[model samples]
Target: MMPWLARSIYRAQEAALKRPTFAYWQALERSQWLDRAAVEALQARKLNALLGVALAHSPWHAARIRAAGLHEAVRAGELPLADLARLPTMTKRDARDNVDQLVWRGVPGGAFRYNTGGSSGEPLIFHFGRARQASDAAGRMRARNWWGVAPGEREAYLWGAPVELNKTDRIKTLRDRLVNQLVLNAFAMSAPHMDDYLAALQAWQPKCLYGYASSVALLAAHAEARGIKPRLTALRVVCTTGEPLYPHQRELIGRVFGVPVANEFGSRDIGFTAHEAPGGQMLLLSESHIVEVLDEAGQPVAPGEAGEAVITGLSSAAQPFIRYRTGDVLRLAPDAATGGQGLHVIAEVSGRQTDFVLAADGRVMHALAVIYVLRATPGVAQFKCVQHAVDRMEVQIVTDAQWNAAAGAAVVAGLRARLGEGVAIELKLLDTIPPEASGKHRYVVSHVPLPAGLMVTA
Candidate 1:
């Protein structure tokens, strides 16, 4: 199937499913070309609308707005972004504790339940609807256009999402072929499977390769070790997500793939926050999110200084994520960093990193694979995964009211599925989960070290 034709057909189907998706996609296409002032104006309009909707439907948000004395300003569309600093910031704990109070479950298109295996300790199951979906899909489409890759173009995902890897039906296989997508499992990237993944990618000749930063770097390292240079003609850019892209990793991935590496900064909670531009700017999807870089004192930081990324997702009408603290440290880039693109710019975001979990069968899996296990398990508060040995894993959990005995069995099953049979899993319920000496919460700590020269981190 021709790439262009596949995109057309997929979009037609998407339009039938929700006409507004295409409308938003097209609007984003034009929005990117708008000036800085215009883009900020659009963000203000959307934020006001989001606040109004949240106040109308969600009593939790209404109380906060009213308490801040900004409810009148929010309703009158006169609230400035700076004034939002006066309001209390929303934490992950706040979202979890007030799920029912925060969600407008009966909004248009209906709020659908979604879960994120976040790198942060708190994994949340929340409700999202048409607006969030459109924001992500359309924003990604526009980002791809920057690299000359269109929707439905031949792209391979080296992802660990269970939903993508679990499909074994003939119908689903045919659908993938029609859409020009090839998915390689990053869940099991052993030397043997890495050889097979390389073969599949070579045969597919995808124009873009997208997946976990560490996994992609591991693949590139493996390719280098074997003295194998992949012969991919159409490949343009390799995009890395799921973790921070270290300098050496980026250099190696680009050198091996014969292309530039584009780093994407976002999490499961905040959908499609930002992507690297061709000019190397980390441009935020300002149309979808309002980002605030704050200092330790809870005030906005000077440009170029490192601070926490406080985000307000403009499209989260079904679930109000107003002034949400993402717990990520980042710095706002100056205009020079963006090439004057005028989109909100991020100089750098140093999110946390976890060591690779080694399977009993010599397979190396991304930490998120196990992190997903703890993240989706309800009733678990703060948690940690420590791979003590090949077959040994210790899970420490801080339970809230939602904790139950069945969650331990589910954890064992989930870990066994990824680490293989005979894997030892012990669940410990704790009063508090402590941070490391560095005051950082290392969600995953794999004591299993990689073979010499196999490490992607410095």
Candidate 2:
């Protein structure tokens, strides 16, 4: 049950599965030496490899790449980024419509296939193999290392997954404990259930914590409200994913945990895209994937311009995503005169499409404004805003100690300020907010169909 022994066993199993741990480590280490030119060279190699694979086995890519005027001998850098842009972005519907054709038929069977939670309401199934899985894990490990976390260190994962109490799940849980991981159910982020989360953290004493940003922010708020700062001296860093880590949420989490909080931007489909480096730099992991910032017309956005993010995975051969539209907006960092790191920098992520609240003026307002106000309020553990209709909205709250009526009043006042007075605000206390079936926490959910006149100004 020793940590080292558990790691050895896990490594053995991974090796048996033909996972590329050693190769992945070598690639990651090599990335430290990469400059923009070197990254271009590496991407060229990956593109060539991917192109060869696609042409030989993938019917979908074979036809499309040829039609796009891409040649097998062409280097990635030689194939202008704009040339790749001409290939239309593939949506979840495309995959569902052409799953068999999308896959490389030459690859072995049993390649990993998983569905993303589709927080944007368009879930898609994607494929990968053991190699891609291993590379993704190793890339994540490299990011965690930036925060001083090692393989054997104790870590707690606050995540939402189907809880299986069966024999297999019990065995898996036991295995996780041996490897120093405690999984906290993200589905139970309600007020009453928060005590159990606190107790688990106190007992587990993990050195690092990982979870959705909203859930961890709620835990921090809960702890601050109850004055129940569990002696989590074992904890050193907190890594948040699955939702945007607003500035206010980051401040509260860092203050409550007494640790540096790092925001990770990625998805199950794309793997890890960016990690917050030391000294507050958002370093894009270009070695693992290629990212493009494109404007409304699918033209590449200049540095420092805000645009949609398009990504392509270099490691995934099971089903390649070449210039796939990610649907998230991002702003590129200002170009550095010295070009310190080869990795691109992200100035900001506008969060998800799902985080919009329907306003009284018949316009949908982004949830960032509401999140900012709630984080400013005291004694708010966690909150979810749901729009049942144009005029009716429900704000679910989970607090640590007593619910402060003044705090509630302040939130309502803030809401009324942003949304008009005609909008109905209902405050409901919940023990926990359940995650969707695909295991994602939705901050805002609107049942109303997209309005015809609605527009996104920013």
User: For model 2, how does the per-residue alpha-carbon lDDT over 1-458 read when each residue is reduced to its tens digit?
Assistant: 45577567667756777887656865786685577777767776776676667767778877887877785444343564435566777665566557788786456534777765344433356787665787677777777777777666788998754323688888878878877788876644444456778888988888789987766776777677777777787887899887678888888888888889998888777777887776777777777677788898888888888888888777767888777788778887865313366777778887553445656554434444455455455565566678787788788876655358898898788767666677788998777767777555566777765343222121
TM-score of 2: 0.75
Most TM-score-accurate candidate: 1
Best by lDDT: 1
- Candidate 1 residues 1-458, lDDT tens each? 79888888778766666636668888988887788888888888888899899889999989999998999999899788667777789888788789999999888878888877555576787888888888888887788878989888999889775723344655666776777888787888889999999999999999899999999999999899888999999999999987889999999999999998999988777788999988888999989999998888788888789998999999999998988888899988767434455688888898878779999989888998898888788788788889999999999988888778788788889889889879999888899878888888888999998766577765
Whole-model lDDT, model 2: 0.70
- Stretches > 4 Å off in candidate 1: 163-174, 336-340
lDDT of 1 at 212: 92
